[model samples]
Target: MAGFFDRFRKPEPEPVRAELDQAGYEEVLDLIRADHKVPAVKRIRELTGLGLVQAKDLADAIEEGRWAPFPAPGQSLADRVRALLSQDRATDAVRMVAQETGMTEDEASRFIDGLDQP
Candidate 1:
């Protein structure tokens, strides 16, 4: 059986085409499936010709498994680190998120804060 990390790993891409070309769809899917909301939303807008609001909704849906946000952000990643104080882990989490998503420290902090909370 897969662990939490494996569970969140994206399903294999099957070459389905969408509003965007296959490459574009795949790119959007890659970011969305990774749960990189901001960039995924921006990429969705570029690929799907969606407005900002639409893109956000779409990206959120992708995260939620609608396309899901089921596990909550960083919940799985932070699971092992939860032994530390939330504040302590917050710093580590920020670093981890920044490395994974290419967000700055401040941006990663905000996102990690959301995940760090119960």
Candidate 2:
């Protein structure tokens, strides 16, 4: 009579650490903002002049903020996006805010979309 307890138990896998250079990280961010259509990996290559694999590694590090930005003042998205695309992802930005603030994605998207409207 075997009980509900299972015989197999495994430990959780460790997180993988990426070896990233600080200068490369900052350059990737700049490229992403500059060329809106470029995917994360390509932006990394163009900016750092690194090969594909190295570029991707750098981009991943930046997204996780392994090398995050220092607090600073700069241009607004409205201006930046206007230069890039006619319509920007206001909803996506709102969702990101919601995720940080512990609000539901739907609620955050609604809130931001409303703000954008007249």
Evaluate model 1: give its lDDT: 0.59
lDDT of each: 0.59, 0.51
Return the lDDT, model 2, position 58. Answer: 59
Error of 2 at 105 (Å): 0.7
lDDT of 2 by residue, 1-114 (tens): 244444464655433333334454445656665654247677555554667666666566555434443222584533432322334545435534454556677876555545
lDDT of 1 by residue, 18-84 (tens): 3545455457657865766688778877666677887788766545434321233566655633533
Q: Estimate each model's TM-score.
A: 0.35, 0.33
Model 1 regions more than 4 Å off: 1-18, 67-118
- Which pairs, if any, clash in model 2? none
Worst 10 residues of 2 by lDDT: 77-86
Error of 1 at 11 (Å): 41
Error of 2 at 107 (Å): 2.2
For candidate 1, the per-residue lDDT at 30 reads 73
